[model samples]
Target chain A: MLMMGAVGLAIARIRDLFAVSMLSGIFSLIGAAAYVVLDAVDVAFTEAAVGAGISTVLMLGTLALTTRKEKLGGGKSKSTTAFLVVAVTGAVLVYGTFDMPRYGDKIAAIHHHVVPRYIEKSGEEVGMPNIVTSVLASYRSFDTLGEVFVIFTAATGVLAILGRARRRREDEEADEGGSDTKGAAS
Target chain B: MMHRKVVLRVVSKFLIPPILLFALYVQFHGDFGPGGGFQAGVIFGSGFILYAILFGVETVKRVLPPWSTRLLLVVGVLTYGLTGVAGLILGGNYLDYNVLAHDPLHGQHYGILIVELGVGITVAASMITIFNVFAGQSGGD
Candidate 1:
């Protein structure tokens, strides 16, 4: 947590976009470590792969397409509004946490419900030793399918937007060549 | 950019196969271990991305062309949906794994394996496709 906070601070202070991206990657790696310590190995694996690996590459790709340095600007109103939003959201979340059970409480509301059944019968029903996999792939297969569709949609959206730009450029170049040929022929 | 570095190239050449092998391991071993389609796919994609970085985008594209990547992306999703459809056709509810085999337990195993494979293929293809698009854009610009 301290490492994450330090990385966050470094990111905020860094004006160089490349450095900031690298720091964020470090931040995610630290977060992944934290998740592992919390015993959520699946979450940690995802955080490490998506957060530190693909995201870092994507950010660097974005930086390549754009600029390495962040634009320097001081917008007092924007900063004030952002502060107000963050403060209100944090306050609401903190208030909500007051009604929540403490971490690792065996008698927590979640543990009392379907979790016990899932833990006990997942092996018999789903026949998987890894309860998480059984729960995700069997009992909660629908949700996983939805998640896959969401990824597919997101990838499609990205391809459509980026591919269109490239194709448009090609079409314009072709148009220019056609006009040049017409002029020469005429 | 690092294509000129022979040391980097040689090391990556050595590294890429193992990375891909690990990805397959993770994909197949997820039911008993700490990985699944998502992580496996990311690992698989990263191997290719590493190859692209060490070699060149054009080289990687030639190996796994954009059109094929796009096709695989669709195929992965289709594979998932078809697995569910097979369940329905076999007199089970949507995505119900029991009917996937004669024995319910074996069916569950087969269902999970097939779906996870679908997930792995889609994820790997999607990541590679996204990377290719982004890299191509940067190069074009």
Candidate 2:
């Protein structure tokens, strides 16, 4: 929670894209660690790698093509409105938390049902100790396929961005050559 | 050329290979432990990140040419998608591992391995390529 607060502060205050990227990566890693502590290793692993590694690189790459520093002290002020909204949201969240389960209650609703079946039978059937692996690769393989699609989509986006610039450069080069030819002909 | 940071330079040289190897182990050993293709990919990607951080993006690019990165990225996606298609052709459902080999267990093993490999390759290349793009844009600016 403290780290989360620090991350929010850093994201809000930092201006340098690289610094912001590093901080956000830190924030993501922390989230992964939090997930691990919650006994969700698979989710933690995904969160750590995708959130911290790839996302940071993508955001930084985009920032590199654009402005590193945002216009400070020139944007319109929304402090009062933002504060009121935040206050209301915080109050609601806190209210909701009062009805939530206590940490690490073994009999929690989440611990019931088919998960136990997976945990018990996965090793014998799949010969894999990690039930998460069996679940991800065998049972929920389609979801993993979807995840691959998501990655491909992101890569395509990056290629499109880079490709646009290359095309623009080629157009400019063609224009320059056309003018040179016209000059020679004239 | 700027004077290099002694610690980061030496550390990266020794650290990058081990990190990559570890990533492979994680990918392969995922069936037994707490890792898989995605985690392994990031760990492998981190090797390139270390390389880029220590030696500049130019050196990293030279080592891993952009065309190869793009190729690997495509190949990874193809590898994953094709494994599923292969399963389908074998008369099972899409990405059904039971159809991969004569024996269902063996088929599952083969299918999982190939799919994970594809994932790892895509992950590592995409990560490095993303870094390269940013570095290029930043340098140009």
Q: Which one wins on DockQ?
A: 1
- Candidate 1 lDDT tens digits, A1-186: 998998998997789999989998999999999999999998899899989999999999999898999888879899899889999999999999999999888888878878989989988988888888888888888998998888888889899999898999989999999999999999
Residues B42-130 of candidate 1: C-alpha lDDT, one tens digit per residue: 99999999888777789999999999998998998988899999999999999999999999999999999999999999999999999
* DockQ of all predictions against the true structure, Cα-based: 0.84, 0.56
Q: Give each model's clash number.
A: 0, 0
Per-residue alpha-carbon lDDT of model 2 for B71-137, expressed as tens digits? 9999998999999999999999998988888888888888888888888888878877777766765
lDDT of 2 by residue, A15-59 (tens): 777788888888999999989888888889879877887778777
Clashing residue pairs in candidate 2 are: none
Chain B TM-score for candidate 1: 0.96
Off by over 4 Å in 2: A14-18, A45-65, A74-77, A97-100, A173-186, B139-141
Worst 10 residues of 1 chain B by lDDT: B1-10
Q: After superposition, how far is residue A125 of candidate 1 from its true place, in Å?
A: 1.2
